[model samples]
Target chain A: MAQMADKGETFPATVENRGGTGRIVLCCEHASNHFPAGWGDLGLSAEQRLAHIAWDPGALALSRRLSASLKAPLVHAPVSRLIYDLNRPPFSAGAMPARSEIHDVPGNATISAQERAARMRAIYLPFHTALHDLLAERMALGLDPVLVTVHSFTPLYFGKRREVEFGVIHDDDPSLARAIVKAAASTGLRTGLNEPYSAGDGVTHTLKLQATPYGLPHAMLEIRNDLIHDDQSVARMAELLTPVLNMGLAEIQRQAKAS
Target chain B: MAQMADKGETFPATVENRGGTGRIVLCCEHASNHFPAGWGDLGLSAEQRLAHIAWDPGALALSRRLSASLKAPLVHAPVSRLIYDLNRPPFSAGAMPARSEIHDVPGNATISAQERAARMRAIYLPFHTALHDLLAERMALGLDPVLVTVHSFTPLYFGKRREVEFGVIHDDDPSLARAIVKAAASTGLRTGLNEPYSAGDGVTHTLKLQATPYGLPHAMLEIRNDLIHDDQSVARMAELLTPVLNMGLAEIQRQAKAS
Candidate 1:
């Protein structure tokens, strides 16, 4: 399945260290803003495509650092969420949104049902199935795997500026998020528990669909895009985050053992 | 779209009095459990297909009666919820369930992303789009609609008997559910607020996606299937619910005006 990286392959997601046997599986769901071949520009100008509406600019770099730091396997969706939002439940109005922020997605505004289905078949289900199978294999080996999907958000939305820097998002299970938020506070970062977004905001699809059903401890990490906009900043942000995440996981495992 | 019911049409949803100018719109997302043409029986035994897992047995008939009683347009998905689950955001595991209750859906257990997309194009999206369009038209006409989606639950699940005869479910908005619960108190029937299922059960997609976004006052009614299993019982259930719903709506309007 890792051969999915070949240029001709239609599967929209990619896996790094596909055979890595690790306890924490890190995924950068909005890792890239690469527009697919046929869907030209999604009816957006070049400037708009480069905006937060396309992908989380620094999420991939942070995920790479965490993957290395935690020695965990990393999975990524390289396509722009604008084409197929990996985080949204399929066929949702937000799935192929006609509008994001102030810009209208003209390509998505009036697609026929058949066309939307084609996008899902080509991009969505496979990406999720890959991650699902990866986690299943680990669970089959009697391993307790923890999942953390990486994302980033704009500092300002609509017109208001958002204050939360590190957003710890979760679905029904908030154990992992609780641990992460506690550890981050010790590291002197502004963190919000379920701030900016939660499972209610049509976010947390990956965790809800893939992790909660299996009873796996999972959480979503949302970084402010401004924090990791450049290479050096991304590396610095990663340096601050990698150890915090490791500490959080250790705390969770310790609590689990004590219980 | 009203012609969606014509014999030659491939779409499996039906609309009743699609042009009705009433202030309430009724939708039965799981009105039928008829298996689709190619997805044969979803690997279920004949008995299983005829059972509660296939569809809410008494829901459609009750919806029909309510549509008439309220003089509101009624819309339904004639294909089984098992096909694409019009009520679920597509891509959800339950949307094209590989399992229902204790029975495994062998046919759905393994399907290509391409095939899932085809099902969505042919059946899923059209059905929702039809309903969306119906409600949108009413809104365009400056009509304030209160929505009530009808469904039924098995009296027993996983060998446990569920005592609540009626469940009033909602998303973030609790105004309508609150009103319905208050009105039902006088009827001397067991009613649970968000019982049997809730927004957490992934059961509130229609309300959350369709109703909540538009600020429409909506509630999902889940009756115990056994209570309305037969024709006389179905009529009786409608007789009991129709006025109660009207009363609830009046209460909501009254409450809104008071505020």
Candidate 2:
């Protein structure tokens, strides 16, 4: 509540299904492109504001569906990644990037250090700290939480088409990701291990920061944006990915027990 | 002392001429190329370690000379800028850059959020906080401290030779910078206003952060590295710049009194 007052009308993040008994902790870092009342479109055109550069299109809807079906807790950022990317560490340039693809974020171009620090305190720190605390609480309760961040990538990057429909990305430990990749074989969906983006691309910051340090099983699920643009598609995709996620979770549990 | 033990032998920053009785505060953000005990060259070759990318070649010596000549206090970072650039906010990518020009910093490429935060606490925050506190102390003493950051740039960048020998860069207000430029006309040295680099290049962070909000007069001095690479040259450059700096300070003081 104090955080809301600190930065006017911005909520750092929201958590739904917090009491869910599932081990999976779903994260949607780039869930919305909603600019808070004070931050005036960040000098973006209407088309640019709705672009994937602002936030991942259809990511929140799909994440909500997955949260429901998996009965898992969902932690999602409520503002545009343009304001502060929850996935990136505050030290990273990408966290408050001045430019993304072809769009120049006029507002971010010359942000003073004090303003930058304010946003970090108001948004980035609260979001990650809350998630970290939630994970710790679950671990204390004898629940081994699996970090599964959901995202949607543009079907075309730099004007080139991306063929991989589903990306199961991992960093450091790969057991959960490998399991997910294997589970995808039954559905005949086009799945790739760390496709479109990889750990080397600095896309796995959330996993590396929150999950790897705890040695918890984790995987970042990146679906092609075009595939989940509408409600029907989002629901269908969630339905398809649900069993695969369950299988992966079961396999990781079995492996953990064996070890 | 606790800071050294916490990070295994890294001094966050050092304050020289701390009790100097002058209204000017000198800062050298990239003062050393000394990587502390544990950081291990940040995965660079011997030549790359000594390159301008690691640290400003003779900026510290110049800053020290100016500190003595002008009776101003100086605050400087002791570790390499490659570890953490003190002039940048922690959120900016350049603060702990993964790459500098053609050099790839292997150590910075995959830094975790925790590690980034640790470096900020160890390096960036301490340096800036010390400078901030010093300014506050000066103001409390009725000493209207003027912020002057000293830095040096490479002679050749991306295989192209730079022509500007002296650069007076500013942001928001250019009164002090203009005075310095006006004073430079008496000397035969070639000078440019916001040349080589400018506020657009994100080089004025120190001025904007430390001085602008308080309406303190500030200017960042950029010397071509070749001019100040050795002791004799550093002393000579300092001598030439001190009068110009003094004149600028006098002119700003007159303007301040008039207002």
What local lDDT score does residue B151 receive in model 2, on the 0 to 100 scale?
95
List the TM-score for candidate 2's chain B: 0.95
Candidate 1 local lDDT, B104-191, one digit each (tens): 8787887665555556555665676567656654543456777889999998899899999999999868999889988998877899
Give each model's whole-structure lDDT.
Answer: 0.79, 0.83
**Candidate 1 Cα errors over 4 Å, as ranges:** A1-259, B1-12
Per-residue accuracy of model 1 over A1-259 as CA lDDT, tens digit each: 1112223335547888766666899888888888866676777889988998998988998888778777888999968888878777554667778899988888788766555555665576667767765675565344677899999999999999998999999887798899999989876778999988988887887886667655689999999989998889888888888878888889889989999
For residue A176, give model 2's deviation from the true position in Å.
39
List each model's interface RMSD.
12.3, 14.5
Per-residue error at B240 for model 2, in Å? 0.7
lDDT of 2 by residue, B31-117 (tens): 999877556778889899899999999999999999999999999988889888877755567877899998899878877655665
